[model samples]
Target: MKWITHLEGGPKRVNHAAVIVGHKIYTFGGYCTGENSREYTSMDVHVLNTITFRWMKHPISDLNYYENDDILPFKRYGHTAVVYKDKVYIWGGRNDRSSCSNLFCFNTTWHCWTATKTSGDIPLARDGHTAVVWKNYMYIFGGFEEESDSFTNAVFSLNLETMRWTYIQTTGKIHAYIID
Candidate 1:
């Protein structure tokens, strides 16, 4: 595995929720500590040029496409991000105070963000959910909900083309234990 290091200058303490695409690493909403020591502060979208190892802040004008200006998915942590069809999708994470159920998509081609209005049954608000892209669908499983403060074993799938969501059923423990 090849590792690269770069310096980011901003809030001293920020939550980490990001993904890597090509040579560029994109980090979405995260919280940071203020000079006054308040928490739950939201941060803007930031990008890192892997080749140059430099950080660049995204334009504020483009942020609207992501969702609500300041109120949307602001400075969230424990959220998950994945790149599909060259677009990045972020969903379900905790901000400074509460957990969210919003889903946002970033289109690299347009250099803008847009909120996804999903049809069908949507997953409940959660954080720490693991999302992975398999074929044309994005599969999400296993996460903790702040409201209940409990771990969930539900599985869900998002159809990228139809913009629909559906819950998956599992029998028994759905275990994949490997014994040697």
Candidate 2:
């Protein structure tokens, strides 16, 4: 196996989120370990070219530059990302203090993150969740809540075209975990 090594490129992070669109891999926010036992989350974005094995740091642009009525995703990890159409959607990741329930979308063509405005039943703030995009819809399930010290089995669906969130009821309780 030929291992790819490019230490001088991309974020030096752990628990970060990455998604492959076409042949390029885009990576976002994660945590960094510091000396003296310290850790902090990152908010940078990077693009990696698989064919050429090169990296291009695509730092997030200024929030004010975008004309939109949405907030930016916080610097976090343990979040889930899925590529639907040309946009990469990032949802539900936690930081040091607490978890987040916000949803953000990054347009591959535009190369920007848009804090998505969602309606209906938004899922609870969580981490360690799994997400998959299927037929213009994103399905999310199972994560953890640090505040309550609990695990979730609830499933959620997000309509990528309409930008809506819906809760899918399921019978049973099963504690699930996804390590990175």
Q: What's the CA error at residue 32 for candidate 2, in Å? A: 1.6
**CA lDDT, every prediction?**
0.73, 0.79
Cα lDDT for residue 165, candidate 1: 94
Q: What is the clash count for each candidate, in the order shown?
A: 2, 0
Where does candidate 1 stray beyond 4 Å?
A: 1-15, 35-43, 61-72, 174-180
Per-residue lDDT of model 1, residues 1-180, tens digit only: 765664665323355567788898887765455432123433357787878877787774244423465344455767788899889988888765678777788787777666788888788888878999899898899899777779999899999889899999977856678999
TM-scores, all models, native as reference: 0.77, 0.82
Error of 2 at 24 (Å): 0.9
Candidate 2 C-alpha lDDT tens digits along 84-131: 988899998887777888788889998877778899898889999899
The candidate maximizing TM-score is 2
- Please give the distance, in angstroms, between residue 33's alpha carbon in candidate 1 and its true position after superposition: 3.5
